[model samples]
Target: MGKSTASIDWLHRAPPVSGLERIEAYFSGFGYDPHRHDTYAIGHTLLGVQSFHYRGRKTHSLPGTTMVLHPDEVHDGWAGSDEGFKYRMIYVEPALIQQILGGKPLPFIHNGLSNDPWLYRACQVLVQRLDCGLDPLLEQDALFDLAHALNNAAGVNTSRKTFDYQAAERAREFIHGALTRTITLDEMAEHCGRDRWALSRDFRLLFGTSPYRYLTMRRLDLVRTLLGQGHSLVDAALTAGFTDQSHMTRQFRSTYGLPPSRWVRMLGRT
Candidate 1:
């Protein structure tokens, strides 16, 4: 059957963004070209069915289901229905997930879909359409859990390695505490007492992400909390060391899955 496709108006229709990134919506039959991204694509189908290809398989995903597209995976998006489909997704860098996963291999989505309770609940931990400050260690714990949950869901067997968890954790803390200012691997090395490349590799191994990405997430985390406290988006962006609101917003949606306004509204309701 023939189908019609149109773009989902991100400015008018998308929900408020939380930290980093949140949900991104698009119309069914609206196919994104076969493309690769340098981040993780985490999303759920809302209306009709959404279909895509990954790891050389043709698969279709439905509402109530989660779709995970690993970083750098070649994939294409299209509606699975005649009426088309609508859904929202968050594009998170593998670095973030990696940090959470503790530098394990990126989670594979051969199934390309999941309905596991753990996976569902992980997605929900993030307040929908709202941004807020994290508890002192809540975000750290959440990332750890998300990493473990995704690892288990993907059925990856943990690998044995002579890795130092303490050093990586220390590096993450140093990075997190200084997001409002510039950072460098040299500084991280000095703080963590590891050479730059070795520290970067171990950081990825322990957190499943890089030091730079971890810091960016920290900044995004701050932006959300500041915005919730009645701070102007532009002001929050500047204060967070982001180039501007738009820059922060773009990266924010990619990480948390929605835009800032929608996230703010959701936070307001809570």
Candidate 2:
């Protein structure tokens, strides 16, 4: 039998956006191993059948349906049929959602899939534009729509909860500024004028992940930038504040479902 288009796997990633990562990919067989990250994975299957295991059950995403995987959810991906599958995805930080929602709990789509037009359209606006970066104001408008659409899709109440949004934002800003050095909850708490334990709890409630994970992700973001600029892996790791290359590699795979080298290779290809 002749080789089909699905015989080979490839991926293309968009230029980086603050708080967002977008990619389009095709897979013939097994894709990512079981992994989890602290970001909202949202997108659609464009061709064939895209399959994954989420929340202890097998889930299939077909064309026209939106897949909304909440932050920190364990999942893996593969092709559901012989022809394989192609899909586009946008990884959105929950902190961005919290910024717009004023600290409401992160929205969740039932079973990690949705057919809601609101969400489908919102996702399309972000994922369909991989060829170039979005204008800042336009991106903000799109995110506002997406945040509200997700909340509506999840049927979450709009009632305000007891959260320290200012404090959390303060700590998040601090993390962004201090990614090259070690950060402690005590330091963050003091900087934000909140008790350490309370800040930790509120950070989880408002940002959908702990402070430490957020800091680590920021560092990983730096590593990606350095790698893209033609730096060696060891150089990138050290510059990004990792103990060494091995440590950065472990976190990179765990968070992104692929090693840094493979990710760069995929990006390098068409």
Candidate 3:
């Protein structure tokens, strides 16, 4: 199979927006291996067939359909046919989604694909182009629309259970401030003024991922930025709070579906 190394140049890169990274790429056959991330992989396949295994079944994403891969959901990607596939994706952290949902469970789009017009339109603001950078206010508005469309499309039960959004958000803020330090559940609980176990559950429910994973993701975010700024992998990993480069590499690959070096190369930074 011919890898689209030439197409890498067509990939437009933009700075992240409130933990949201946007990219547009074309894959000439197999794309990414099975991987999971602590953020929702929201995207639209612009061309060809985007196939992936999600929720125990192989799903094909076509044009005009929105793909919402829930946080931490294992999935892989490949073109469904020999012609390859082109897609635009926005990786949004659940904390950003929770900011709009206000402590509700993250919305789930069954089978990882949706043809709902509302969802398609809402996500279009972010996935429309790789070079389209969202302003602060516009980004907030887009996130709100996306969250609403997701809940509406999924028909999520809003009256299921009550959780403290304030508490979870507080812990999330603390994690952001202390990403360089070793954080613990007890410390987060004490800081957020809630029981350790309750706070942990609330964090997972409200944010769609565990507290540890959230912390790790934040650190990984830093690692990406550092590496983009020309820092060596070892230095970036160590500075980002990982034990070592290998440990950071493992986590990075697991979350991003590619090793750090490959990711950099694909960005044409090398």
| lDDT against the true structure, each candidate | 0.66, 0.86, 0.84
**Distance from true position, residue 133, model 1, in Å?**
17
In candidate 2, where is summed lDDT lowest over 10 consecutive residues? 1-10
Model 2 segments more than 4 A misplaced: 1-7, 158-161
TM-score between model 3 and native: 0.92
- Order of candidates by lDDT, top first? 2, 3, 1
| Runs of candidate 1 exceeding 4 Å displacement | 1-43, 51-59, 69-107, 115-149, 156-159, 224-233, 244-270
For model 3, the superposed segments whose C-alpha errors exceed 4 Å read 1-11
Better of 1 and 2 by TM-score: 2
Q: What is the lDDT of residue 143 in candidate 1?
A: 57
| TM-score against truth, every candidate | 0.58, 0.92, 0.92
What is candidate 3's CA lDDT for residue 214?
90
Model 1, range 158-238, lDDT digits (tens) per residue? 677666666777887787688788889998888888888888887775554567767776687678778878998999999
lDDT for predicted candidate 2 compared with the true structure:
0.86
Total clashing pairs for each candidate: 36, 0, 0
